[model samples]
Target: MLAYRMRHRIQFQRRVQTQDPNTGEIIVSWETVLFSGRLDVPAEVLTGPGRELIAADAQQAETTARINCRWFPVDRLELYTWRILWDGRIFNITSAETDRTARQEWRLRCSDGLTDGQ
Candidate 1:
């Protein structure tokens, strides 16, 4: 990974659990965690919402980003367990690829999309 390009700090989490403070009840389901460290986002693809920001439609927008970070061992099945955390938004890790030749970094495709009424 390029040290200079590692300007953004990102964290990879597999699982997250949230609970209601008052009731002590589980508010969110449990999830696994990846790792955390500085990262380089050389490419960020933002597809427009395609229409005007009216009301509920804005929640259906989609955003994708290409992230590059230091190499880490991850199994194929574990891809479903990884999520990227940055800028207060959680980006799901859709896919992951490693640099076989150099073994230097991992190319990650992430997306932060929402469904209607969400």
Candidate 2:
């Protein structure tokens, strides 16, 4: 059996804004994100026509969207929505702020047994 090895890692960085209730000045915070995962391609999947390996450069360029003060404001009374970009689509993942600091393994593989046809 053979496995597709990941050639590189995915990374993200964020800037958050906090405000002084009294001064109304914005304070910025920076966060670094790191993700490691593999891409699984099944032999049963097709490699031509509708089924093809996704472009290597595009796949390697995949990175998580950055969440900033514009998305999550400090003065705002409500929580902001989180956004994620997969493939070429932009999606909203959550409507609440992630108020915790914890690291866990995040795995994402194409079970569809298809690549981007590149």
The global Cα lDDT (0 to 1) of model 2 is 0.29
Top model by TM-score, which number? 1
Report, for every candidate in turn, its global Cα lDDT versus the true structure: 0.60, 0.29
Query: Model 1, stretches more than 4 Å misplaced?
Result: 16-59, 115-118
Among all windows of 10 consecutive residues in model 2, the one with the lowest summed lDDT is 40-49
Question: Tens-digit lDDT track for model 1 on 43-85?
Answer: 3233223433344654455676777777766675686566766
Candidate 2 Cα outliers beyond 4 Å, as residue runs:
1-4, 20-23, 27-30, 34-105, 108-118
Report the number of backbone clashes for model 1: 8
lDDT for each residue of candidate 2 in 14-111, tens digit (9 for 90 to 100): 34679989999988654333233323212111112223344745433232232221122222122122222334433232223333431212222221
lDDT of 1 at 81: 66
- Residue 2, candidate 2: alpha-carbon lDDT: 22
RMSD of each: 5.6, 14.7
